[model samples]
Target: MGKLYVVGIGPGGLEHMTAKAKEAIEKSEVIVGYTKYIDFIEPLIKDKEIVSTGMKGEVERCEKALEIAKEKVVSIVSTGDAGIYGMAGLILEMKKDEEVEIIPGITASSSAASVLGSPLMHDNCNISLSDLMTPYELIKKRVELASEGDFVISLYNPRSHGRPHYLRECIDIIKKYRKGNTPVGVVKNALRDGQEISLFTLENFDDSIVDMFSIVIVGNSGSYIKDGKFVTPRGYSL
Candidate 1:
């Protein structure tokens, strides 16, 4: 039987690609991913066959990769950590008769949080604002609950075409349970080229600045900005 490596390529840069991930890609005869992600690794994979897909075609892409892997060694690539809102879940769901190996990489949330200090040091939850598969009401409910529980939130897929208002709604919901002065940080294309970081308060979150590539971190009431970095004290060193 052929082997399959489900690899995470990190956020964007070639430097971020883990050695194991690169080795897996090099050993594989087929590399599969979204077009944007595939483009990021194009230079590394010169002789391999690339199978890429458009947006919202994750399942189809994975299925195609699996079919090809049955005959040839294949590597399915995802940006950031494969387990966190990445291709890990889909690949697992699609794997029935095949044995797959997952090679992990840095998650965007982790990278973003590291750059902005430590907003996730305390109790925190990661939420995705994209409602393509989930209903808006459900997303709102999750945000509301997380806010009421005083959990810092790391939001993914915060903004995109035809879904510009979701992030604003998330901010509004969190504001109702938390203070208007709560710290919020936006990290765009974290750890990648043209990376940008923006800090603001819950009351002043700039909706105009967010995009699909951005990750928005909303801190709890205990969170604060120190020297331009947003931090939530973990109480470990207190």
Candidate 2:
């Protein structure tokens, strides 16, 4: 009669995690997550049974957690908010009448937004460039629509060695609706070791520096950079 807790650890650091997420992990006798995400919370679960898998093993990891939760309190972790591109949905989808609790934490988009100032103050949409689970054509369409709507856009899984040009292609699609001067914020390893934040314009953005560890925010038409801070005006009279 053990329960499952799906937890979001947040931005590769303990400080970024929520109290409920921490408590869930502490209460679990078995912890599960991707290899790197597991590393982020290694100190907390050192004494607990850890189950980790590398990339593309998400289904396997979730299945393992379901099995273990039958006998032990199990906590499966995701890097960002569990519901946002995290493990919570998958676990819920695969379970049958199992008691499950979702513990949310800061998502990468919000973490990156905070580091870059306030690019997300206005209407925004998050779109992942990775086509592994989604088709590239659909992803491109979403990017185009987000740009057309003038919503601040956050791009996740922007680039990697396997798909080096995906980010560039997405930028080109965004260019169709956004001006070259629109502000863009790129954050690498946000709130984590070796964090880097850069502010630039859509036309001059250096996509070469972006990788899997990066999150890119493309501002709406009204967004701007002032005093080295990237911000989107919420239309409030000041």
Candidate 3:
């Protein structure tokens, strides 16, 4: 039986991709991933067999990858880090004692943080606002708790056309624990083409600027904005 590799391609850029991730894809006979993610590495895996699916076909995609792995080496790719909001978890949960390797890459939170200065230099947590697999109520509770704990927060899947007001609702919960001037950074398409980085305050943030492609970083109470950058200090003496 051939081995299966779950790899993180990282921000859709070859520069951001780890060497191991590239090696995994290069060695695999087949490449499987979301359609957009597959397009990101299209040049690299041009000669390999590609099995891609659309938005909600995650389960079907993984199942196909696992089945293909039984006879040939397969690399299942995920954008950003596969472990974080990617396919690593699902692949592991579904595989049964199969020889599987997980290759980690830069996560979106860190990619966005690099563009927005050091907003994640201190303690931080990532929360997804998408309610397809998880309940919105639970997500709200998590946002509130993270806010109360003063953890620098990275929000994934902030908003979509179907759930337009979810981000606004999360911002309201965050406002209850964080100050109006707390630094908020929005990075769209981080490390990828047409990247846009914007800094805002918790109170003045424009939800309209956010979308499924953006990663929102909400600074903790100690976070600040300076010289057009958002920063969450690590509390070291000057």
Candidate 4:
């Protein structure tokens, strides 16, 4: 039996890539991941066996990595924190009798929040709008509840080409609980090349500006913008 390391690369930046994550891949005999994630760490994985799969091939990739790890150490890479929408869960679920290690990296919400402002200072929840595995109704309910609870929301997989309306629908539901002027921050390609960040309001944010790669941080009722920064104060004055 061999060891399997589930690593998160953290938004494609070498600096954002944790040292442990890099070391896991460096020490591994095989690296398995989606093509994009594999390429993100291509520089550190020279001469290593890379088994990259295409989109929606996570299960195949993880299984293949585990099979290879049967004799040699393997590293399976995910984009953000391995536990948060990464390969950690799948790998653990599929771990029949192998030593599975999860090396977490900073998740998108945390990194994006840093880039945008202090929108996640208080109670917050990170929700993905992908709807690939999660039902849309359930996602909507989560959004509504998060909104009603006055928790800041970090939305992942907000707007894809096929699911363009998901982000808009989610924002609409959130607006029912939040004021129309509620602060919203959009961070695209966070911390990666071609990064973009912008601030908008609940009623004015155009869905066209976002894509699958974007993370939208919608502020709670008490959230506000200070000096062009989106901020959700943590009772500092109370």
Model 4 scores a TM of 0.97
**Candidate with the larger lDDT of 1 and 4:** 4
RMSD of 1: 1.3
lDDT of 1 by residue, 1-238 (tens): 7878999999879998899999999999999999999999989998889899998899998899889878889999999988888888888888888779999998888889988999999888888888887898999999999999999999999998889888888888898888888899999999988899999999888989999889999999899989988989888764
lDDT (10s digit) by residue, model 4, range 153-202: 99999998888899999999999999988999999999999899989999
RMSD (Cα, Å) for all candidates, in order, is 1.3, 0.9, 0.7, 1.0
User: lDDT at 47 for candidate 4?
Assistant: 93
Spell out the clash pairs found in candidate 4: none
For residues 1-238, write the lDDT of model 2, one tens digit per residue. Answer: 9899999899989988888888999999999999999999988998999899998899999999999898889999999898999999899899986789999989999999998999999999999998998999999889988988988999999998988988999899888888899998999999999999988898899999998999999999899998999989999999
- Please rank every candidate by TM-score, starting with the best: 3, 2, 4, 1
- Give per-residue CA lDDT, model 3, range 117-170, as digits (tens): 999999999999999989999999999999999999999999999999999999
Candidate 1 stretches with Cα past 4 Å from truth are none
In the predicted model 1, the residue pairs found to clash are: none
What is the lDDT for 173 in model 2? 86
**TM, every model:** 0.95, 0.98, 0.98, 0.97
Assess candidate 3 and give its TM-score to the true structure.
0.98
Alpha-carbon lDDT of model 3? 0.94
Candidate 4: 10-residue stretch with minimal lDDT: 229-238
